[model samples]
Target: MGFTTPTPIQEQAIPIILSKSDLIGCAQTGTGKTAAFLLPLLHLLTEANAGTEEENPKIKALVLVPTRELAGQIDQAMEGFSYFTPVSNLAIYGGGDGAGFEREKMALTRGSDVVVATPGKMLQHLRMGYVDFSQLQFLILDEADRMLDMGFVEDIRQIISHCPKERQTLFFSATMPPKIRELAKEILVEPEEINIAISKPSEKITQAAFSVPTGLKVELIKYLLSVKSVPNCIIFCSTKKSTKDLERELNSLDIKATAMHSDLEQVDREKALLQFKSGEYTVLVATDIMARGIDIKGVALVINFEVPRDAEDYVHRIGRTARADSRGVAFTLVAPDEQRDLFKIESLIEMEIQKVAIPPEIGDSPPFDEGNRRRGGGGRGGSRGRGHNGRGGGNRGGGGGRGGRSGSGRGRKPAGNRR
Candidate 1:
């Protein structure tokens, strides 16, 4: 992996990191951010181990992520890249059996050259008292923006408090929101900044929007999926209830579909994702938590069940497609009340989303300026308020509990740290 030509992030960030400087990498999803830091970290570890005899490993590098899926993804990539080198690694995250916890205990206590972990699960190990980072030399926050969004600020602070005072830090994020900048200022020391095509959706993704009534979204989705050869598609909803309702609706319509959200057990969620990747299921309905770090190569379509809270999120959702060096389509169903949301996205992207006419079978669309006349259906299946069903416990669920309590709150520690 290191032998391949370096991407823009790798080309720039690797050298600065090799020089032992802190760095802030701003890049979109799927732009080789993993290798940008992993290649250099592995090289450093290999150099440090050149003449030394291999002993029980002591943690030297710590990578903190926002989700278990991301932790696993990074850990798998590290194992692939470090195959030739003697460096060892482990991924510690929540959503597993007790045996999984025991295995993590063994890995953390025995030590690994590199440890990739989610904040909450990592905190559990820390509280137990054997997980030590005394020898830690590198501390990296991958997807720092998402970590912040998932309300890991206090957890991150507590984790940092356990690490060595003097260590190299690297912060990688898709966008430099003000909160991210604030976190960077607090954590980094004279860091070099690198930005590679942030906010803009991938060129390979054909973006389009359908102006349909909130009630007709299901019909529009059915029509689009039938017409387009969407071998593997993800329908992104704003809440877990919506994911469940949509999934149920699609399956009832005989569309091999599954729903993913925080409400499902970790194993089920992982299974659904795996099945979706293997083409066992034609569609997956999920919330924004899957927006980043879950990679399904050559995904043919990404349908936004509704406009996301912001343009950055839309970019992440569309990024799922147009990945693995292939072309894909991103279709958004915009209700009449979502015009301003669409406008925000258009302004951010500097282009219109090529609004498409609603299908005749779906009936009359809502007014173009229907802002609050009947702005219903905020939650899933006619339920309101951030997942009324017993599923508001995902690491990414519940905001202050109304709008975005789980994401983008000021530096407060989020609830549901049990995992």
Candidate 2:
């Protein structure tokens, strides 16, 4: 592996992990948190398993994640990091055929050095009575908050019930909500805590939004893609229906785009993601499922066709771009009803995103008003603005004028040294 200076999370986390103590790590997406945990764990496993000649190698480490995509991503990264080493690993997730399940069963029974899995699939295997974790020494939960959000808390507990209680546990989450803290208390021992830029998007991302009417949001997206010629873009919608609808509209306009949602088969989802990553698809229209954990690099832009319901989700959605010291842009289209959601996001990010004026050809857009969100005002009555010239309007609504109030004042203090 090309070794260089570690990222902030890696620099702080790797040492703690190497100490063989439980740990709680809170960091934003794309901050090298995965490598932070993986590198140290791999080192320990390689050292422990050296010269071992047991007939049945028992599983030593387990990583539980929320999504299949993240499981596969971590599995690939594990392969690369352990390529020259003796460590063996496997990724277990649903949506595969019987042959895939049988392969996972073989690996689990024979004991891969490390096993990464989604909670449901892992629980399914655990119920079979053939999988054993008596020798497990490490238990890791990546995206703990996301798992809780997906209603996997009980499933996680069930999986943990099968593991050895004496094992070291690591909990990594992008956000440190109270629920996460509770879960951490139940799982991890006196673990060293590390929080790195929690709930903050990378500073390299150029953030802006267009206050378009709900009806004309698709037209504005078309204008941005066609006139501005944005390449490698990811447009996020709030629902699967919206994703499919927008994809259809973009395809109708001769734009090469694909849709990714939970309804699609796993193979189709993987193919769509591959096409997006390979530049065969110029744009990927997706729901919030693609917001976190799926790492596709070199994306030029992230567009939020609708505001996410949760403020923290906004951070993750924009985080798809501007990863790893690269510059990128994020845009949000705010409908009148979604103004409250926008205000919440601005409050969370601690800055009022610049409001780009809607193109006159796309018709007038509603004013940036959070108070009038309940009225559901349309674009017909708002003042006409100039075309897409990048001129931004003054701060409006509950954003507290320009830079919003600091989020530092709210939420519990991070349990460890803040970086």
Best by TM-score: 2
Residue lDDT tens for model 2, 1-419: 65588987888888877777677787777988889999998888776666554444567778999998899899889888877665667788878588878877876776666789999999999999998777778889999989999999999989988876777787898777789888887777666777674555778999988988899998898888876566689999999999999999999999899999999978889999999998899999999889988888788899999998888889899999988868898999988778877776766665668988798989997888756533432322211121111211211112011111111111111111112
Clashing pairs in 2: none
At residue 217, what lDDT does model 1 achieve? 93
Error of 2 at 256 (Å): 0.7
TM-score per candidate: 0.86, 0.87
Tens-digit lDDT track of model 1 for 1-419: 43558767778878977877777777777888888899998887676556554445677889999987888889888888876666778889878689989988976776677889999999999999998776777889998888988899999988987876667888888766678777777777667777674457777889888889888899888999999966889999998888899999999999999888988878888899899988999999999989997777878999999898666688789899987569999999988777777766765665667878786777876655534323532211211111111111112111111111011111111111111
What's the C-alpha lDDT at position 262 in model 1? 86
Reference-based lDDT, residue 400, model 2:
10
Q: Rate the local accuracy (lDDT) of all candidates.
A: 0.76, 0.78
